[model samples]
Target chain A: MNKNEIDNANKYLSKFARLTRNVLDEKELISLSQEKTLLDDYLQMEQLRFGFKYEINHSEDLDLENIEIPSMLLQPFVENAVKHGISKKATDGKINITFIKKANDLALTVTDNGNGFDTEKKNNGLGLLLSESRVALLNSIYKENRFTLAIQSATNGTKVSLTLSDWL
Target chain B: MRAILIDDEISNLENLRTLLEKHCPKVTIMATAQSVSAAVDAIEKYLPDLVFLDIQMGEQTGFDVLKLLPRRNFEVIFVTAYDQYGIQAVKFAALDYLLKPIDIEELINAVNKAEYKLATQIQTSQLDFLLQQLKKTDTHVSTIAIQMQSETRYVTLSEIIRCEADNTYTYFFLANSEKILVSKSLKEYADLLRPNGFLRTHQSHLVNPKYVKSWLKEDGGILLLTSGEKIPVSKPNKETVKQALQRQ
Candidate 1:
């Protein structure tokens, strides 16, 4: 095999292994600082494969560094946006992430400027379905309907927002 | 022994050739094919004694080639990455196969097994049995029926605490101090119960994960079950047993 082909194969294997590890590494919750660190690492990995700009915006009111949230909570939405939203578009795209501490809840919004999909359709794929189910499970585990996911899409772009009610 | 290598990837074919050359000197490399049609042509032309075949070859499957073969005259060693539902069938029939990212030891072992089986009379009915088992396992059923002398018995997989091998018969220990014996090998039940959270703790025992209360890690290992029964874990199976316990 040529050097380029071998390199590509090795790269794909490493990427696959990393993603599989991430998926299988399950826990109930993680500290907000640790979650941010993981998201940073994941963003670095995704940037290598998808040509899109990733931005992080957080509110100044809350101390997120010491907080804890459900495991694998926010990563899947970013992954879905990159895979279904930006990757399919013709030209360059941007993913805007916002972490807002509301009065009664902490909300995360992932907005992508690419081809918007039908929010009602289940077939946009497993990422959304899995994320929704995971959030529901987290809520059930917490013994309250505290976690909620909202997905909204327009013709120009799509937005997915997740809120943890009375989030700590 | 003449062998033909069939895989869609050239690199895998070359690697297998090297492995066979170094590990199995008794076998001669006859030819190689990279696709289903090519594999069929090579098999017909060379009439090899053994065929090291890959399961997936792009659009065509290795089964297609196996079906087109004039007769089941040669031994086949399947090489594949993913097992899915096919491996249960393969193991059920006692056929030889090597998982990819192949190990030299497994390669030698599978070749030796193929040789031993080829020397004896091959049963074509095993394939049919495997297909039947595959059909049954395709559904997401949690219960398995065991046949006794007069009538067939049924038990949910979760109801059984463990299975113990008594020669060809298997004894199922249930939660309510009930014991039932069935006329089937432990290997068959092991293959069936494996995907259902039952870990084969020893050659004679397969313990359910939910029923395992504790592991006494001395004398190989012993699992303390919820039913107050302790099952002995084999030496090599100790680490796996520990990992599974930790996961639980």
Candidate 2:
């Protein structure tokens, strides 16, 4: 992106960050999965432009016992997916976000059916790198291997999975 | 009535001091603090009965000062710059606070009331209860006191139509065609009403449980109220409506 385009994108991302903070601050009692979905849907609506669908499906009894993470960790990831994954495609797109608890971890998977890219390469842009760093921070709070970040891209789509320590 | 004036601006500090001294002679100006550290130290050392606090001083707010102190012994009269919304918040809090360019008459009145209340030995417990209720008003279901002309009425949590926030006032729309202006914010009312079956379906609107006729899912979602007024539903609160409807 050029200077003006980069500046505009930065402004929009900052706005998303601010709105996320406002929503979190105003909400008194938010569960972990609920908070994550809130950030995800906010980014999906605010960042995407075309025919994109965002769905958050989670079963009841999700482990959310007094677990609170940073305010806007998922927004950047969602933004990265929309900007790089879906925006490059001409057809409609859909992002499915699912939260599930297994064994001793809380697992989240975000999958989108759009133009995929090479995940082996290190040039995942600042947004993706920032997302990686955030997951690393989440790892620091939980133990090593308590947090996992995985990205895979096929010919038609991309899937990103994150697993954080089960605090419940 | 002992008080402390804390503000970075010399002119504002001096102006407030003059106003307090002239109009509220009973309120003794114990000391003044310009910075956060100085203010904290003075508050600890002098322990004034009240503090005429400026919200903005360099980078810190009056709330920061309150957070730093272990326990607030004195009451606060927050002197803000131009946040009428914040002023309304303070009013809703029922804690005595004043706005800047401190009006002499208003300052005197506030200080006098504080003096009278203090002299009466009004239970700190009661004052604390009021303060607690005020803070909870921002996020809990609260019975708003409304006065219309000669008649006074309080529209309960279930009778509210919607609340519109306009600067310092929130206009509460009732089931009847009457709108009562309360000195609070939409968020405050939402907090007060959330547990009482009121959902903040819109950023600017809060709906009672008995009023939602149907939900319309279009581009975003909208709620058709019993009065046929269409209110936009905030995406975050869609599930809240569903949950509420299920319980109903």
Residue lDDT tens for model 2, B1-248: 78889998888888677666656778889999898888999999998888888877887766667767876767677787654434544543445666544545557777776676556654343233334444554555355444333333545556677776554357888887877876555555665456667776654677886888887887467888898989876544556576787788
Error of 1 at A78 (Å): 33
Candidate 2 deviant stretches above 4 angstroms: A1-30, A33-37, A40-44, A63-66, B1-248
So what's the TM-score on candidate 1? Answer: 0.41
**How does model 1 fare in lDDT?**
0.72
lDDT of 1 at B39: 88
- lDDT per residue for candidate 1 within A83-142, as digits (tens), equals 878886634778888888887477888899877888877687877777777877766565
Candidate 2 CAPRI category: incorrect
**Per-structure clash totals for the candidates:** 0, 5
Reported per model, the fraction of native interface contacts reproduced equals 0.00, 0.00
